[model samples]
Target: MSFGDIRVAERADWLIERVATAGTLVLRKLGETRAGEKSVHRFLSSPYVSVERIVETLAARTALQCTGRRILAIQDTSEINFAGRDKKRRGFGPAGDGKTPGFFIHPVIAIDVESEAVVGLVDAEIWTRAAGRVTSRRSRAIEDKESARWLSGCQAAASVLSDAAEVTMVADRESDIYLLFARKPERLNLIVRAGQDRSLADEGLLSMALAGAQPLRSSVVRVAPRGPGDKGREAIVELRAGTVRLVRPATVRKSEAPEDVELTLVEAREVNTPPGKTPLLWRLLTTHSVTCAAEAENIVQLYRLRWRIEQVFRALKSDGLALDDSQVIDAERMFNLTAIALAGAIRTIQLVDARDGGPRPASDVIDANFTVALERLSKKLEGKTLRQKNPHPLGSLAFVAWIAARLGGWNCYYKPPGPKTMRDGWNRLAATLEGYALATQHENPGIP
Candidate 1:
């Protein structure tokens, strides 16, 4: 079916609507009457509507309202663990766990760093291999077909992002090692935290170049905290500056490594911390030239934007969707389940963008359609015990859950017998609240 023809059902939209509070389980429960688990599953699993499209849609809508520089693309990965089994499956990648197995979700997210608004999402696979003792005795076995296919997932993701207006790949030390960034296609510029003692060619000392100059020593530098860094809050280090000219890049001793490229090393102050704190120093390397202090400062500011991905990760893992809640039995099904949850999270973000009233809400914005559907659901359960005792402010599911959890009847730990338990729970709650509403109306009919 064409995207335009897709119907916005009362139940589906209701599920989407509650995603902000009740989360995926509530959405699935809300969907059970109008559509089965399979239907909700299909809606989430289909690739036609992806996080990329959702972000792009928001970007396009925002673009019509404001204008700015070309887009800046940032790429990074996060680890999501799986309960280990003897073997792995397609789309599951290694997660750096030496023992228990896991997968990597490498997302290439683009944003207007200036605006802090995300505009695109591209995910790739990084499959894992069992470490020593988990697999065969042979130490250097080539990957079997199941794991080898992730190479294409990586390349395909890169190919799609190759055309971004301007691309900058950011990562921790893992991505800084020579192979991943240095060997990446030249079109991509990278800003990564470097590993200590990585190959380097420091040009002849600047004092040596200038006659009768005293040798340079450590200088005092002030470190100022900017906003949060990729890891956490960032600080700037300032020192007596000097420049180095590079004639050749540092050579890699290993034959398997990529060829070297030229880099200039300039040293500055020793910025140490209190007795409990460790000293800080930055030995930065980049393909871009640093002609002035302002340029150097901009690079550090840009790297700080890497923290934005952390927020996205939180949104996927804990913010409402709880993508990790899936109970799928195996790797393929687990990955498919993860992808579905990501779509739900992405949709929730879009819905919030559509409804957020500034930084806070001044009044109710739930549409008439959603309000009526909720009322209908409440009416349908009037005869049950869970009548609208004190119908939730605007009758939101979130408010209902809060009430149930406080009223001593709702057990988050309760395991329902089957899929029907969700609908039954809501019906019960509605019946109680509705009855209360009726009693109050009868008692206070003349007051209002």
Candidate 2:
């Protein structure tokens, strides 16, 4: 949290201060003075402000926010590609595209399942593959591959949310690793989309386990778009759930691996195709017990929440921060900037989510000192009638959002404010807080 030194702390604070506003990640643009710009560059290049330190700071916040909540620890990996800039960049390796030069980010974000609001970040692993031909998977162990992050993600959620009432780690297909399920802590639960047609102890394929299972229920699901600009479609899918014992593969190098691991399988298969559109089918495997239709539906609902990370990714790239537009070419500095940009993107999404009037507290996103000031600002925005007043409780995140939407010029008559409006309002609110702090410091000397 100290960032190793007073100067380092100051520099890191400055970066977080402006980045949290959901603005651009450009250093000079974000800086108030020439020295502030240089400070940001130095902070990213400093060995003290490493990725581990920043993640630790985020995890500490997560631990405090996650207490007594049922958590959906959503884990995901995204690639940051710098294809044509390979010549100018240093200390970099191949991206997922293999030909391009870039790196990968695997993040685990915590969400309170009951309130369905983001709690905080549990962990993030940032790394790159060495340049050259990759080794064959058949000859390598799980620890020697990028897939190890899945296991580490589980470990992180366990340690960070030790006091949480319940923890269920959710992931997409890439996390369907046998070792992960076998070695997962007993205290932690798992829900990963099945990618492999793994063998079963019953001498059957995992893909066939639910083929003949009776339909427990049906529901409509939103299908994601095929491309960047296209709107997604909706589909009606039938749900089915069953249990199976997965047999460990012969190629598994872990001698301690169990012969079989029991897990529940939940399937949501599309009922009918609308023509030309892709069908919606999800084969989810989990450690949570499923005995009824309502219980199986809960699993499907939680797995759908994985899309929240995709929204953060969109905000981090094309929609909000545009991290690729940054001019920093050095790989080390880029990595640090990536970490800051990610925090900014996630916070931006949190504020946008708050705009809809959730039950989340104001302190979830703002400092306690700012709440009193926010209350004062809230009063100034109210109109004559009670209908014009903010409907949310005084200390909630929705209260802050109402103030922000008002600052962004929302009439409170149309549909709720969008992300751009929320971002504009949030920045305005942040600038007002800065002005308030400066004004009060002269009188109280150290009040903030």
Candidate 3:
């Protein structure tokens, strides 16, 4: 059924509200009552609920958020592993281990490039690989292969964000496909980490061609802590950039002819490393011009924002949603639920990121009733000192965020609240709102 259908629209609205009030918990835990549980199950099982339609609606909202702004369409893939628990489960494929059952989800998220605020999701695809379906990459067309997800994601984002003044597709090494560069749209630009060292037009390797250029500039960047027991450090890296024409590979689809593609290569290599740290080296291929060191650094800064999608994944799985613990056995139902969870995760990130600097209205991200409740709670949470007072304007996103952070145990002394803090705050707020509704109903029983 279309989104316009009454039943479909009502179910969609109900699911979104439930997910927002209570983060992506299991179906049984998500529903507050027996009737609510049954309704959610029926909605998920209905033929009218579709993952594509849900994603399209969210993408349309994201496009509206991107009006009159430049956005970075970041793409990445993460595996949803349900293998260890469900050996006999149908409609699944191999995961990290060949014997485990799981599927892959790739999503494209739009973020404001300058402010680094997450706008929303543009599109997403979920699929499973069939067992014993190996094929020769050399003989098959690009469209017939699984690697084509990269190109398809880019095309979808381009269409959805057509009104955006500028859209840059940011990806990691897995997106370094030769055919992708050949067929990329003119309006969509790419900045992908180089994965392969291919031959250049002048009979030199890509690495060798880049090595000839002298260092144009050096800059210092702060590297985030990697894992447990590691502290963050500042790194000094030298930058080098050059333009080259890549030679086409000998192996291609029979119908396709070889053509050279012109690209600008930017390399950032750490000059010095500490005692036990590994030096950072990144070779980036891009269509954007890098005429000066400032331009090259801008590309480097854009590439760094790729980690924003990683945060989105964290919000979906362990930090916020706990999606892996879901008990749904049906693949179709799980896919639909995953889409709703994804939208919830984006909302959480948007709130956390807008805590300090984003100047948007609170009504833009949250409801009026919720904001009113938060305002009442903020007075009790804030201290008498100015530093403890709300620094954001009333009715702004940062204002609500400050109230949530305080509820989550933030003392306004350390760094702003993270995803985990926001999750805790959201749970408390939802419960508080529920209590208020109950009290109001008891006080005015005949008003309704």
The TM-score obtained by model 2 is: 0.94
Question: For model 2, which pairs clash?
Answer: none
Where does model 2 exceed 4 Å of error? 85-87, 222-234, 254-256, 382-388, 442-447
Backbone clash total, candidate 1: 20
Residues forming the 10-long window of minimal summed lDDT in candidate 3: 439-448
- Structural similarity to truth (TM-score) of each candidate: 0.53, 0.94, 0.92
Q: Write the residue-wise lDDT of candidate 1 on 184-271 in tens digits.
A: 5565555555554443334353333322323243333333433334223223345222333322223323443445454433333234
What CA RMSD would candidate 1 show? 11.9
The segments of candidate 1 whose C-alpha lies over 4 angstroms from its true place after superposition are 1-22, 25-27, 30-34, 42-69, 82-95, 126-164, 202-236, 239-258, 264-280, 343-448
Residue 80 lDDT in candidate 3: 84
Cα lDDT tens digits, model 3, 319-404, are: 67877767877788888888888888887887798778576678766666555566778888889888799888778888888877
Ranking by TM-score: 2, 3, 1
| Model 2 per-residue lDDT tens digits across residues 1-448 | 6587877876675687588674788788777679878888888888798888888888888898888889989999998888665667877788888878788888899988987777777899888789988789888888888899999999999989998999999999999999999999878999999999999999999989988889999987777655677788888889999999999998885585889999999998888879977778899999999999898889988998888888888878777788766678888788888887778888877887887778788887776677678889988998887756888888889899889888888877768786667777888998898898888877655544
